[model samples]
Target: MRLLPVGTTLFVVLTLGACSPSAPEVPVGADGRTDPVLVQGRDLYQANCVQCHGSGGGGGRGPQLNGGTVAASYPDTAAQIELVTNGKGAMPAFGGRLEPAEIEAVVRYTREVLAENG
Candidate 1:
């Protein structure tokens, strides 16, 4: 095979690096549970809630969802679903934007993952 020019080789390397797939954004939490549903929920949260809720549900524009905050406020999952689906106060309604399954996934993520960790 013919040798590539130095610049061409460098360009190829850089292009390949850029095209490389990124690591999974959802990491297995300290709990060591890697259930597919929870992972999916984490992914959903990152995509939809991270902007306002902060990374790991630490809170930012939206109230902190970690620890017992959400649990204490909305003990019932249905209530949590309502709050998320309809939105309240500063939180915008997600009912229109996300599917019912997506909403359920996020709720489970917040309750099971974030709350457990907190």
Candidate 2:
């Protein structure tokens, strides 16, 4: 049998791992149904946030929301909600435009879905 060098084997394993499928782009409920709140939040994010946060919250003009960045930045859910509602630095406040429920949904989406996928 042919044997791969240690470095080559490690590289192949790492490459395959990288190619593995990632978390679902959308969040689903325990019942296997899509979460309506997440759906609404995703729609709102696409409309309002994608321009800056980028698709899947990968980051662009705005700081990255994925990869646990949101969780790290705002360990407290309420703090994150407040930031979304009030805005900070270059981020514009959504409280004036979005309903309270919508704001909450979007925040949930970022923390639960985007954070995981990233």
Best by TM-score: 2
Q: What is the TM-score (0 to 1) of candidate 1?
A: 0.70
**What's model 1's overall lDDT?**
0.81
For residues 1-118, what per-residue lDDT tens digits would candidate 1 score against the true structure?
9999999999999999977532134456678857777777888897788788876677889998987789999989999999899999989899999999889988888887787553
Each model's lDDT comes to: 0.81, 0.85
Q: Any runs in candidate 1 off by more than 4 Å, and if so which?
A: 1-33
Best candidate per lDDT, number? 2
For candidate 2, the 10 contiguous residues with the lowest summed lDDT are 20-29
* Model 2, residue pairs in steric clash: none
**Runs with alpha carbons beyond 4 Å of true place in candidate 2:** 1-24
Per-prediction TM-score to the true structure, in the order listed:
0.70, 0.76
Per-residue CA lDDT of candidate 2, range 1-118, in tens? 9998999999999999977533235756789999889888888887788888877688889999998999998999999889989999999899999999999989988888899865
